[model samples]
Target: MTRTRGWLAAVVDIVLIVAFALIGRSSHAEAASPIGLWTTAYPFLAGWAVGWLVVRGWARPMRLWPTGVVVWVATVAIGMLLRVLTGQGDVAGDPLPLSFVIVATISLAVFLLGWRAVVRLVAARSGRRGRGRV
Candidate 1:
């Protein structure tokens, strides 16, 4: 991928993470203000950054293997760990509920990996078309 595409992929990932936070907040009837969204998003965003570094994702930003899967796992794991450490919870005593964890795991996987899958499919089709043309 070109540098521009790599950066764009990173931005897309960040936007999706923020979207996840927004949806969660809205569903819970929590505040939808910027500050509220930031509070919910920062942990996951931090995790994403870590994942990018760990995988050097810029080298292959669109790959669904180590890049997408590792980033997805890191985002959820680190995000939840941070939330627990910071005492953020759905209920008074449960900092990380099993139901919420499951939902988050599935939601983020779809959000993060789903886009890459679509991009790969489109690129594959375009490549085939280009080859047939020349």
Candidate 2:
């Protein structure tokens, strides 16, 4: 495996992550311009970075337990925290809704961790069969 792949794993993460925001926006018929999407994405992106720092994610970016799980949790937890600051889903005086919190937590976990788990599974199978056996 190339060091570039390992080193740029976070970039892959960033793309997949931003996809969540863009998809949600499209679903709601919101403008999907780059600036608009970036605004929506920044909070989660910051949370993602925080997650990387918390896990020292580079050391084991592909591992499923602490790294992937921690990153997923941190992304949703901190992303929701930042969302309260952004005033997007607030209703009345409440900055964050219970349903939003629950949805964000579950969805982010699935999206952020799911692919890593799949890749690990595929890699394990491929390795067991010797490379290029696909």
Candidate 2 per-residue lDDT, tens place, 9-49, comes to 68877887899889878887989999989987888899999
Candidate 2 residue pairs in backbone clash: none
For 32-94, candidate 1 gives per-residue lDDT tens digits of 999999999999999999999999888899999999999999999999999988888758677
Give the range of the ten consecutive residues with the poorest summed lDDT in model 1: 86-95
lDDT of each: 0.94, 0.83
Per-residue lDDT for 119 in model 1?
99
Q: Work out the TM-score per prediction.
A: 0.96, 0.87
Q: RMSD for each model, in Å, please?
A: 1.0, 2.7
Give candidate 2's error at residue 55 in angstroms.
Answer: 1.0
Error of 1 at 79 (Å): 0.2
